[model samples]
Target: MAVGAAQYVRAMHTVAVLALDHVIPFDLSVPIETFGRTRLPDGRDAYRVVVCAPSPGEEVATGAFTLRAPYGLDALRTADTVVVPGTATPLAPLPAPVLEALREVAARGTRIASICTGAFPLAATGLLDGLRATTHWAAAALLAETYPAVEVDPDVLHVDNGQLLTSAGAAAGLDLCLHLVRRDYGSAVAADAARLSVMPLEREGGQAQFIVAPWPATPRGAELEPLLAWLEAHLDEEVTVERMARQAGTSTRTLIRHFKEQTGTTPLRWLHRARVRRGQHLLETTGYSVERIAGQVGFGSAGAFRERFKRTTGVSPQGYRRAFGGAGAA
Candidate 1:
């Protein structure tokens, strides 16, 4: 028992957060709060979190306040994981010493993660080259433009490239942290961490869910307004191209062309998205069983619903309910 307890104590991971000048306050706080607060199933703290700066005694400037990090870059040398939070000036060049330190640790096979615009610094180190990454949607273009070799995906909440992970803007950092917890431990422990943060264990949908749908900026949108409303209203019904064409007073081919031009997506794809979105709402607000929710969302079977829900939301329907179900949820 004593030996087992010693092994358990030794299993705690160390997470070093690199605090750069002009770092976003919220980004800096996310890892500190998330990793710092995690507890293992045995009720022991799972991670030892250290916030470090380029220099040990120096104060880093945040837009709102100055923070004195207790550790320095050397802390990264012994850490099992390293995290870089977003900087206010993401486009600004990283300090050479900081960059070198990151490269050294990464070469040693330490797991590293970047939150939001932190991808910029990680990309600048040339580590993200030949890897798919994501930053805040607002900065995705810039990250791609600056590091042409890096594939920047802007429509996902987070991207996990094994040792190197990147997350999209703001609260997505929380998502990435929880994902790491799940990867390191398992779902039950991660779910506990989520509760402490008052967040769902996992959120439904991608960054695409947060993006506003682009409607055609023309009189054509007015013509489709009623059709769109009808589609939304009848989400649980079979919506065939032929039925849509009849309602639009046009041939099927013309309706297909009109939908593509107006929504930049096929009619069926749009409907599927709508159904998944409705499923999400039901999961969040109602205590419906997955079978009932599946049928209500137009899926023919619970098995099909589970697969689609996992594909679209990166989580199963039951998992989604556990995270977001509002009242009387087990």
Candidate 2:
């Protein structure tokens, strides 16, 4: 006699979150909130999120609280996508069973992602070798040192390698999750999700913003800080090297040398980047015409502004505006 078997077919996409010991609450919740809140154009839920632990009914330790995951490793086997958040102890070895499950799922074509130092565990799976990846800026060097085979880039918010993806710390996870929505659906759908989260559809700057913004803690950089502030305040005016030197009370030659020593670039190059960053903000937040924005940002003409903007961002002004402009903007 044959026993009757029951099977249920699932239509909604499944996202499994693997919560290891000492998981970051924010990182773990990002996928659940982002994917869980998404709706199809017709208003149906887009994804079903399942939080799982290494073993069934296991209590995972978060700094603030202990969470007993309802599902076990079995949930990952059938998930369409799997997300791994960073553990409190990133250097600790992953359990053999967990490693085996991740390898098995990845080999079966399941998409996998990690947030922050989660790259550590993902790298251990041998999935990110020879592929570009990123983690929190503070941990980037360590991640690279720990996994030399993985090309580590600490300058971007996230890196997508088709099947494998990694994101930097904290809020960058939100950026990565929204990106997945864009990849699976389209920019419009992702934009809707972004709006729901009160986030920009697409942020303008990359990790360079974080890298370059902090003033160097040196006398050389400190001396130039006032001049940099003045430049920012007067971006709409013509800012020649000679003018900057005058503002800093130095000769042109000395000023150029100091800028290179402090900022790793010439004053003019830095000024151009600042202008472009400002232009990006305008395009994303304002309804001003490109020509007007060009003037506002100190470009001599719309043609000049267009050229500089494209050279800096790899996209035209109008294109960037359309892709990331305010919801009410045209």
Candidate 3:
């Protein structure tokens, strides 16, 4: 099965979720619930999700409770995609049999993904050695320390390296699964799945948005909260550092400092990202032309909008729309 293939080929895509011992219950349930509930336009199921374990019928402890999986490692052989949920003992050595099974599945061109610290076991198979991967921010340092060959990015909600994918902690798993759904079935179907899951089709930012940082002693950092909301509401306006400073009641230098401390980005860069995010939503949900969307997002011209949109999203406006836009997109 090809990645992002046409909808027909994905009608019955098999997704095998590997539930190891001590698997986080939430992580294990994400794919099952997301894929299991997804329906095609004709009312057919999008994916067939199955829970498999290293040993079938054996009780696996999940902290909250112990349950028996109906399938074993052999289930992976027939799956088009395999998902590994996070485990409590992420740093513990993986059993050689499990590692060998994962490697064999990868060699057969099966797509694999990990949720949270599940990246630890996936890394143990050496498939992620040269790829960019992510995990729960709390365990990022340990993951990097343990697997120096794997490039660990602690900021993004998820990293998709074509065949191998990894997501940040907890709810970020939902983002990754929704992304996969979008890839397989386009935006409209994915949007329906997102609605069923009670999650936004796409989150505005990455896991970095969830990271907590120490605030400065001054009240300036707290003041930016309202300014951030103001920026979102005025994304279509021509925003400038001086304008943001005025809105925040601070000097440009002070505003810049506070933006970096609070949001980890410059004010202008944040505005650009905000515009792109808005542009993405418009493209997905509206019948607006690129030129129209460019202006709506505050770009001076369609040409500049195309450049910045591609720079931030790795695809031209048309390309993104083609992949994720709704039927109404023009």
Candidate 4:
């Protein structure tokens, strides 16, 4: 194994967070809180996290507040992993020094990532050529327009293509970091960290969930609020357009038309996905066994659950659990 990999396995991984000037305070805190708080099976610190910047040991305004980071470029040199968080200055050209440091680290096979719009600095190194990545959803179009060489997918929460990874904005960074912990150490360790942070054990739902949230059920008010609440409550039941229309006091045609206009999807597809999402949450957070989980999620059998789970995520419930449930594979 490489030195960094060895160190990581031994629970001595060093994560260097590069904080540029005009940092977004929320982005800076995600890694600091998530990675710094992880622990090994014996409760020993699992990582050595240092907040470094272009000008180490200097004070910089973080949009919300000023921060004093102790490590500098040197920390980047020795890091087992380096993370660059998003900044308010999304298109600001990265300094040559920052580009050089990231390039060197990539060359050495040091693990690296960027959160939110932080992909700008990492992309400056040109290592992301031909790789699929994402930034904040709102920036996806610009990122693709600016860096035509990069494949930008705006829907997923994050893409972990081995040494290089990128995440969507804000809270999605938590999902990506927890994913890394699960990948490196095991699910058990990641679950502990999630519990500590008070986040979901695994959020398999993609960023599409967010991008698709606002417009869905828009023009929402008393007439539709009760219906939506009903949909969420009865995902496990075999709900049809006819039933939904009657409940909403509309005919089937009117109900379908309004739902499609608001949600950009047919009622059945939406209903199916709601069940899948509910199943995803249950799979990640519970140990009810596959049969019971399938029944609870409205699947008639374990086979049916496995089929839908595979179709949606390209993985089985057991596989998803192994990846996100903090346990070895079933």
Candidate 5:
């Protein structure tokens, strides 16, 4: 007599997440939340996300909490996609088992990803050698120095090197997730996911916004501080270049030089970015009409606001608001 056997069919997008000691709970969970939350337009799940570890039923210590992974390294062997999140205990080298799994998965045409400093593990595998990648801005320098073969850029929120993708940090991971959805299913599915999650359709800007309103790492002298604060608080004001120069107690030429030196950009450019950010905040967080948000953010009127917003963010203000707004039914 033959024993009855059960076979499991793998999902097309099998996402395997590596859970190690001292895992960042939030980063590690992002893949599970976003990918698991998604479904195909046909009402089927888009991906299967599994959290796996070295051995079956292994326990992992996540700094603040202890968790058990029901699956083993075998899960990585057949995964269509693998994701690595930053670990709290990354000072140590990756475990041999984990490294082996990464090597095995990647050799089979599986796409590998890193969220934030997860690049560390991937870089160690040498797959990212000579590939353009990025991590959190705070780690870009370290990543470059640590893995000379990887081209690291800290400016953008993330970088997509085809099958390999890396994100800046926590929230940037969300952007990368949505980007993957857009790539796989087109903008419609991704937009629906954004709507379901109650998140912005897309991020307004890059990780550069993480810098700040007017200050860089090295603080400027007290003279420019008050002016920047004023500009931030009152973006609606008619902030002319001449006015900024006067407020900084310098000529426009001198102000331009100082602004470039301090912020790596002209005052005008910086102010434009700030206003766009403000406009985005208003759009997402308020129920105000587009015209009202435009005026409130110093756009002078809705049409001008649309033009400048599209120029800066590549989408019209109304579109941006529609995407980001916790809006009532259209």
Candidate 6:
């Protein structure tokens, strides 16, 4: 009999994290924390994480402080995967030796991923040419301008192009690392790692949500806050733009304008996202039928709920539940 992916084991996978000078501490720590903590069902460590710099024991500044890596560039030669963390000076030219090493490893079929502005160094290696990639939304424009051959998508949390991948800023690194774990083992293992990190195994939407500005501190915006709270509390009820306007003491036209300005989307669209998020939580924690979940989350029918859920999350409710549902789920 063939072993299932989650049950199959070989020698421990080696993940080498490449930390360069002026590395961003948060980006440097994400993969280390995520991969270092993952465990197989048999209670074995899932991966061997090694932090490597261009020169081991050399102090690398992280804006806030400096530290030394135990391994050197040669470690990349033996790694199954290589993760490059962002640096403070992302646009700065990469050291020739570092760039050469990355190209060498990638040529050998070693998987490579970048966190936030780390895309700069990866792009500098020419590996991202003609590939879709993303970085911190704030730096997306620069990444595109500097590397016209690379497609920079500012809206996604990450882009996986088989052998190479790139993640958006900050916390999106966690998403990318979890995705890699899922790709290597299975969703059950990835879900366990997510629980350890106190994060959902798969977050809805993308980096575009973070690019939106927060509600301005104005009277109109302030009123919308209470209206939003009310909407959440009444998600199971029939909601309409007109009803929302009435709750906020505004005309429907004005309410639409305020939502566009403050939330970067129409009121109904926001409600739909909230409903899908609620549905996901319920599916993860309960044994309730999909029809029951749809009704509880305010969808008019199960069919409509399934359509919207898949559109928003790229998976069916049942599929998501199968992957992430806890012991309480049926």
On TM-score, the leading prediction is 1
List runs of model 1 lying over 4 Å from the truth.
1-9, 213-330
Alpha-carbon TM-score of each model against the true structure: 0.66, 0.65, 0.64, 0.63, 0.64, 0.64
lDDT of 5 by residue, 1-330 (tens): 322323123435788988877778988988887888887777667887898877657678888889998778888887887889888755569889888888887888888889888888889998999998988766766677688789876667788988889888888888888888888878888888777766776887666545333224333445556777788888887889999988878899988887766555688877887887788787777778888877887878888877777776656767766666674433
TM-score result, candidate 4? 0.63
Q: Taking the tens digit of each residue's C-alpha lDDT, what string does model 2 give over 90-201?
A: 8999999999999999999999999998999999989999999999877876787788899887768899999999998888899999999999989988898999899887
Worst 10-residue lDDT window for candidate 2 reads 210-219
Task: Tell me the spans in candidate 6 whose CA falls farther than 4 Å from its real position.
Answer: 1-10, 213-330
lDDT of 3 by residue, 1-330 (tens): 333446666558999999898999999999999999999887778998989998997899999999899899989998999999999999878888899999999999999999999999999999999999999977886787789899887778899998999999999999999999999999999999999999998976566444432112122347688888898799889999999999888899998888877655688887887788788878878889999999999999999999998776657788777767775733
| Superposed model 5: Cα runs more than 4 Å off | 1-11, 212-330
Q: Which stretches of candidate 4 lie over 4 Å from their true place?
A: 1-11, 212-330
How do the residues 1-330 of candidate 1 rate in per-residue lDDT, one tens digit apiece?
234767865777999999999999999999999988999876789899999999879888998999999998899998999999999998888999999999999999999999999999999999999999999877776787789899877779999999999999999999999999999999999999999999888877777544333222221345666777788888888889899888878898987787776665688877776788788788888888889999998899999888887776667788777766766453
Encode model 4's per-residue lDDT on 1-330: one tens digit a residue.
Answer: 334656656658889999998888888889888889999787777778899988876797886788889988889999998998999987888888888999998999999989998987777789888999989877776677678799887778899989999999999889888988888789999999898889986875566544423323243334566777798888767777899998899998988887766555677767766676677677777877888877876778888877876665556777767767753234
lDDT of 6 by residue, 111-130 (tens): 99999999999999999999
Q: Quantify all predictions' global Cα lDDT against the true fold.
A: 0.85, 0.85, 0.86, 0.80, 0.78, 0.88
RMSD list, candidates in order: 7.3, 8.0, 11.0, 10.1, 7.1, 9.9
